[model samples]
Target: MIILKCQYLFNKILSKFFNIYTKLSFSQTGEDLIIQFIIGSLQLKKVTYLDVGTNHPFNMNNTFLMYLNGMNGVCVEPNPKLFNQIKRNRRRDKCLNVGVGINNEKTSTYYMMENSLLSTFSEEEANRMEKNGEAKILKSIPMELININDLIKFNFTTCPDVISLDAEGVDVEILNEFDFNTYRPKIFCIETISYSTNLTGVKSEEIINLMSKNGYKIFADTYVNTIFIEENLFN
Candidate 1:
């Protein structure tokens, strides 16, 4: 049964990539396009986003295509360079050069890594990655820390349609800080693992459980990211 399901999904994904990859591939693993396909099938329109840890405007960004598709939203990045890039490139979207979380203070140290994607605010995670030789810490810079919900409310006139989160090891922390009932993003594309792969890993179940309790269903798993859809949206 597992093999049959895998084969079915493989065929479906293959068909999707060949059909609309060019139009919908702003995300690293084509998550934007895959979500677009599902949203289209559901007859949904006017998609907006709250892109947390949006590293770049295009490279590995999950919300760039949404911006190009006439959807306006906010892009939050702790790195000043990347935030400026997003501001310059995606002029229509609100760009914030700050980290999203409930810090005790207004600012926190953001560890810049050799691989920019691995850069994070968690010192422990950074140290672990550096020890593992997975990443090298270049420097630590003070970044403004803002409450996630407050940022969303200030930027968005209405609730966001989607929320794509990729904040290194702090992804779950950011998710935990969000008021799920108030924001209630219809779709979520969240990085659930420290490593990237095509196969789902063990660490994702905790995130899945959290989202499940929030009335969301696991829609897809791209190993690095786990996509969730609000349960009520399908009704």
Candidate 2:
């Protein structure tokens, strides 16, 4: 997530003299590291999480660092190819090869894009990606769907400590379905920037407002994503 974290650690002598202070965050931004800092400061020995639209296990993944640190949780990915890879590498996690949907649908049409990261269950989103020249739709498949509430209910006894969600364009829809009253996650790292090749990408204000209305405040905004912490956590 952190680009050139050791940006200052370059030159020949410096490289040999000092170890590169590498970036451990796998998030597109330094979201995982930020979340880790906050949660680690809480002094909890362990934490739990739920990663939605987990495209890759360790690449541009918001929850991978936590996994490496011994935190356990579930990963939901619709693309079977990606799911298999995550399941293989994240052996300790409960990897579910299914799409998250607003309603409890038996199955939904999932579009696999040329760039797997652009894949989505929303036909409109898939079409928009192709129309905008962001990516090409490689193929489509009927993937099983799961409700967010049901997901948390079945996977966790209480609620997970963190929910790192990046469901392409349906992220807010998923959040809207999350039973916040029943379960309150302490932190959330969500992809809040719209995808764009040019400089046309815009922040999702709706998401910011929604989180605020739910008594969460922005912990950090890295342009690509935003990290939120429940206000009560400070109390």
Candidate 3:
């Protein structure tokens, strides 16, 4: 009777321990998994990020988990509403209410959509959405626009460790403006898909070529986002 009672007690303790462990564990997404791989491979406890097109502070955000882990950096979102939301939720991070592109324009017309994540600076994307009736315009805002490289120089004291780029349809333009030699992010989480969900409109090959020239290799591609890491870093 005593042995059976002890076994029951041990089982209860084991069950309680697992429950606690489960509560502490979080599965964010494929982005989080890739981020974890970078951190683990680099043996880094904290990292910095430049999150462009930060639609929501949490939902679909690649840097949200990093932020929770005491990592802070610039979050650029052109949408006023979403920017405000990011400001409220991410007090530790620097929030910018501006669009980033290849040229430093003083003001640019931002296409704000009902689902703010669908917002883009690309006229082609906006027109496509309108024609398909996929997304409705919430409003148009004349937002400040800066070159990606210039914005990084102005915001961060040093280059961010990781750059999470998700600029809807203009991601390539942003990359073109980025001076990879001057500011080489250890890891890049970029959305290669342009207008379609089926990867039909993705410029993945171009991005891969660009990164390959810079000595970075494709670390992982989760369909929606592709992760690249500097080849020298892993060694």
Candidate 4:
């Protein structure tokens, strides 16, 4: 019976792969490139993704591709307003109104701006803006903090296939707190907003070095985002 079950699952996976390969072959050039890279690099029919700071769940997310390919995962957003937006957009996946950082605690007084895109938890960046005389602040709800390990203890049966981080100014801090040796996700997609804000932004080289220390290699570096894959996984 165990062998029969394994054979059934193997046949199902082979069928799915053939279908996906056919669809991919006929897809548009740009879409085909992304699908091929993700499917080929990760070697999975369905992926588990974690989108940190998934504000508003815009249409441009790479996670959307996973969803289209019959994958499911969690979306974490700290801001209440933005979290609601994400919840509305990603009704199929688990959406959490929490922040990913070094610890699990309730934080208060997160800064909100009229332009929601500028909202962040970094008071230092807010203060720098005040110095530059362009400061705009509004009171907002606090986000519950949870580390990556905490998530593993909760819902994840296995490490996520991909983890995309877009936590505004705190991307570096979140990456630093990740124990890559333990939860080595297959791919990491991080936003690089260094040019947009006056925050103490991390340089591209700094990001490369941090990922390298954790046994990851840079796969792609677009102007707005950088992609990293586990070195051992790709080999």
Error of 4 at 79 (Å): 2.0
Each model's lDDT: 0.81, 0.86, 0.78, 0.67
Candidates sorted by lDDT, best first = 2, 1, 3, 4
lDDT of 4 by residue, 114-174 (tens): 6565567777766665566655677666666777677655868888888877766777887
Best by lDDT: 2
Error of 2 at 191 (Å): 0.8
Which portions of model 4 show Cα errors greater than 4 Å? Answer: 1-36, 103-105, 129-135, 197-202
What are the RMSDs of all candidates, in order?
Answer: 7.6, 4.6, 7.7, 8.5
Q: In terms of TM-score, which candidate is stronger, 3 or 4?
A: 3
Whose TM-score is higher: candidate 1's or candidate 2's?
2
Global local distance difference test of model 3: 0.78
Kindly give the number of clashing pairs for every candidate: 0, 0, 0, 0
Q: Which stretches of candidate 2 lie over 4 Å from their true place?
A: 1-22
Q: Give the C-alpha miss distance for residue 9 in model 4, angstroms.
A: 27
Quick one: best TM-score, which candidate? 2
Task: Give residue 156's lDDT in candidate 2 (0 to 100).
Answer: 88
TM-scores of all predicted structures = 0.86, 0.89, 0.85, 0.76
TM-score of structure candidate 4: 0.76
Q: Show model 1 residue runs off by greater than 4 Å.
A: 1-24, 196-202
